[model samples]
Target chain A: MNKTLHIALSGLNAIDSPGPGVPVARGLREASGFDFKIIGLAYENLEPGIYMPGIADKVFIMPYPSEGIAALKERWEYILSVSKPDVVIPNYDAELLPYIRLNQWLKEKGVASFLPTEEQFEERQKYRLTEFGEKYNIPVPESHSVNNLSELAEKGKHLGYPLVVKGKFYEAGIARSPQEAEDWFLKISHKWGFPIIVQKYIKGEEFNVAGLGDGNGETIAAVAMRKQYITDKGKAWGGITVTDPRIMELTRHFVTKTQWRGPFELELMKDARGDFHVMEINPRMPAWIYLAVAAGQNIPLATTQLAHGEEVKPMPSYEPGIMFIRYSWDLITHVSSFQEFSMKGER
Target chain B: MKINPNLAINDTGFAFDPMTGHSYTLNSVALEIVQRLKQGQTEEEIATGLADEFDADPVIILKDLLDFIEILRNYELLEHE
Candidate 1:
């Protein structure tokens, strides 16, 4: 009997619908013909099976009731022992820390995992990335992480009007006027208890580049896209495939400079000067993995194959003008709120 | 609402705004709603027509139609008459 290669995915909550990891498993099955299993923790009802058929042999669910690290680690250890997967891949942002902590344990159990070394992981986080961008002549928004209104006001003056105040972890964009920014900071800071970063809003076209990197800092394959439509809450609703060699070179440069390993998504903004500013880096798969595959580059499959010590080749040509319209059920919900606003002449 | 004369709708549900080179793709339901609105059909009449044409519940179809109409209006694909 052939040994099965089980790929375990974390952060399988229904609320994080259409998780990025789902497509990775799907692509792995399609490209390499492997037996995959998914281990997800659900906070709510999630249809009770794998979203994509045949991608996972079985899905094991765990109840996640608290936000403590200890609770999460305990659950993770229990799931890892039960599944005993060949490789463990984390699908969400917060799961990275715990996954890194258990990296040694996973290695001892003969399961492969990809993460930065302990020192590198801490150095490449959001704050350090921002600082590194400045050092390398890479453009980044003027940002300051603050915890109080007094600090926010001082930072707002430096960043100018119409700044964005956002949590350091997990929370998305929240753009507001200086006063509103301060007010929101006070409210959310107390609730989330954060070191929130406030930055000057960059008015420009947004682009994202997703790629897989070897542990030795080699970019195996990559895809670039320009966000054509965005939701009010800052999710990319629709995106167009872009063919800018400069963007690709910049992405390669950033990844190599950071010496990053595993899968990564680099968020960038192009200013009027045509300079690509590095906004942030997601050290995981992006939400548009399917779109990237549709555009002729399958990063998920490439990552899996690369992890298995396979030599992956790059595409000589890709469809440049291809575009994707991401239609989610949530967009239907936005339609009703839009109608109510238009009725009141508020839009 | 009325269809903007400046905007062009192709048979394949490709929408083009001549003013701003922004192109959009509409699904089948959204395409039908836009077509009906262009033909100057009332919301009620369009809802009834959709219900009759597709094998779907009338109440759910109407709700979907109205919601799509609202999106079209926001995108300037429809103009209030």
Candidate 2:
């Protein structure tokens, strides 16, 4: 009989702009080496994965990272007392910092997690992309972070029109004119706070590579996919894996240079000259990560093993031309489950 | 011969590449070219047959055929030579 590993993970929204939790759970379920019992950590009760069948054996509501670390730790303490997890994987960007801070505490409590260091995480912030690009010798779009609309206009002149205005954490809009740029600046700043990132808009096809890097400067797995269809929210609705050696080489270079630990996704743009510009680097698994598992490299599975400090062989090859089309599914369940989770903070 | 072997085309000009799961809808002329390519017709042969059937300038037909082939190449419906 295989030993059961209780894996606790967050980001269970599974909405249009999905969290990576469901796909990660699905990937974990497919692991051949161990039996996995999933514990879902959610901030809201309405997260679809909470009630979705075959997703989680237990669901617990945790305080948001914005609520401060003390509240988060208290909630985790209660959770750990009840349903002990062998490993915890926090998938949301906003929550990653708190989890990283609590890594050693979790280790003391016998819960393992593999995550990027504080310096590694800080260096890849969206506002610091240009510096990151220069440090790593990667081609990145010229960008400037502005504190107010006046600074936006000042920098907009240098960068020219049709620039991409981005928030620190989420939301990005393409502004073709000064007025449009101000509109985006106002919208993103109001929601995500100051230091709006304005980037030079590169005209070309976008490709994304999801990879897992060993802490010692080696890529364990990398899967590249091009978005066939994009939604209004800028998430890939349909994507196909491609055989691009250049992109693969870049992925390795990124891992080697960063000595990046754990899972990351690189958003890249290939211009007409076939040169790739590093667009953004997400510090965790992407929502379309299941596509990687289907193509032959199981990143989530490898991440789980890494979290447990087990040796994982590099997965160097995956079948290209594999496609993944996202579709929505409606899960029907009683309101009682919602009530139970809301009242007791666990169900 | 350069067309992807995994491609499947139906009577109504619907093309699907099973390997990549990418589908394309071809026009009548484009469909004819794909079918001819599938049957091992060379570019010159396809151009000649298209010119005779349409009673048009051979040079124009060949140019248009080449453009369409470039589109196919961009979409990765053709195998790497």
DockQ of predicted candidate 1: 0.03
For each predicted model, how many residue pairs clash, with residues at least 3 apart or on different chains? 1, 0
Candidate 2's residue-wise lDDT over A1-347, tens digit each?
25799999998999999999999999999877768999999989999999999999999998988898899889889988898899999998889899999999989999999899988999999989999999999899998899987899999999998999999888899999999999999999999898899999999888999999998999999999989999998999999887677888999999999999999999999898779999999999999999999999999889989999899999979987788999998889898988999999888
lDDT, candidate 1, residue A30?
Answer: 60
Interface RMSD of each: 7.3, 4.5
Give me the runs in candidate 2 sitting further than 4 Å from their true place: B1-46, B49-63, B67-81
Cα lDDT of model 1 by residue, A1-347, tens digit? 13566777654332333457556665656654555444433333342223434545555554343366576666667766666776777766656766677677667776677765555556545656567666655667767778677888888888777777776654545556776887768766775567877867777778888777776767776788888887665667778776677788887786677667778788888876667887777878887776778778877666655655577775544555467676534312345533543353121
TM-score, cand. 1 vs. native: 0.70
Give the winner by lDDT: 2
Model 2 lDDT, full chain set: 0.91
For each candidate, give its TM-score against the true structure: 0.70, 0.90
Looking at model 2, residue A45 earns an lDDT score of 97
lDDT by residue (tens digit), candidate 1, B16-74: 75433357998887788878877888888888888888866778887877787777766
Segments in model 1 whose C-alpha atoms lie over 4 Å from true places: A1-3, A11-18, A41-55, A62-73, A173-176, A313-317, A329-347, B1-81
